[model samples]
Target: MSVTGAGAASSTPASGAGRRVVILRHAETVDNAARVWQGHKDTELSETGRQQVAAAAPHLAAYRPALLVSSDLQRAAATADAIASLTGLEVRLDARLREVHVGEWQGMHADEVRERYPETIAALDRGEDVPRGLTGETRAEVAHRVGECVREVERELLPGETAVIVAHGVSGRIGATELVGLDQDVSDVIFRGIDNCHWIELVESSKSFSARSRWRISGWNLGPWRL
Candidate 1:
């Protein structure tokens, strides 16, 4: 496995060995720039988004990610491609890494969704599972799948190895919270959210054959501007 900036931020004491997992949100997309809901939409990166990657990849290179994994969606894959080139690693694709599926709301603008689906928007804000257009996965569903993805990767990791996961916003947040052992409500408040191309580093360190219950969330929102 590759190594670099995969450190989990946790308050729990360390005992056994643990690995780091970096969860990165894909770069900006045309839909993102337009404030459109891109759930499961195969959107490409915007011009600005490509520039974001060009500027951000070098900073990420410093982390020297050992294994690069990404959502099968083009936007996320494109961003992962930049890192793969920099780190000389191949990108592993997983559909479970894709963003939350918003069903009928794909391509709709934020204002349009807020106006037409006020209850739906409110439900999301409260961390409730309200379908965004008569059909969509609930918050619990998103958390379950993404959490599984994180655990699967974590289980595969040997000591000092790090994996970089490139995905979308909501799913990324869910993954981080789940990995950190935070409940849904608490995670919603703590993670808040991530911007395009930003990333969260969750490190799981263990010592003396004892795994700590708490993981850490360091390096939050590491992005083009911040990096």
Candidate 2:
């Protein structure tokens, strides 16, 4: 079944024997500020992004994350570093958590992309799951790799522990959708791009044994209120 930030029916918080996973979108990057497509383009966080990290770091650290992982890209790595600074955990770099590759569209402004590929843009807005930039990975491709990374995290985390993964906007949602086994159609329609420095939390149900129904999205687009 598909789950939405606003549509999930019920989410059983992890019990004493279950685990929690938090997939965090990295802070804003220069590309983000400029409304550019940054698929696989390594960019540093903007000054505002650094401030966002300062506001958001304490909350993620409070989770006392048992494992910290992130995309190798500088933007995600930088955000992960902040949380690691407080938690004393090593940041495990995972390429699979990187954003959907936009192919030829990397570094292009959103306006340019919209003008050049109106049909593609329209298709995406309709949740068609097509390649983003004529050569970019399709949503399914992104989900496959993202699913691999998330499942690995599931194995690494023990009951009563929380794991934090620093991820990109699109990939983060794909990972969350994979973890919760939400209906893809529902996710495509309902799960929009998450805001910078925000996060989604997934908890494994202690009562469920099936992979398809074991996890739930307990929170979505949650972030710091200060700054």
Top TM-score: which candidate number? Answer: 2
Tell me the spans in candidate 1 whose CA falls farther than 4 Å from its real position.
1-18, 207-214, 224-227
RMSD score of candidate 2 (Å): 4.1
What are the TM-scores, per candidate, against the unseen true structure?
Answer: 0.87, 0.91
Model 1 poorest 10 in a row by lDDT: 1-10
Stretches of candidate 2 exceeding 4 Å from the true structure: 1-15
lDDT of 2 at 192: 72
What local distance difference test score does each model get? 0.79, 0.86
lDDT of 1 by residue, 1-227 (tens): 21223322223223344567889899999999999998999999999899988877776666666678899999999999998998899999999988888987888998988898887788777777676566978778888998898888887866667788998898998888888778888767755578788888877644324343547765677654742
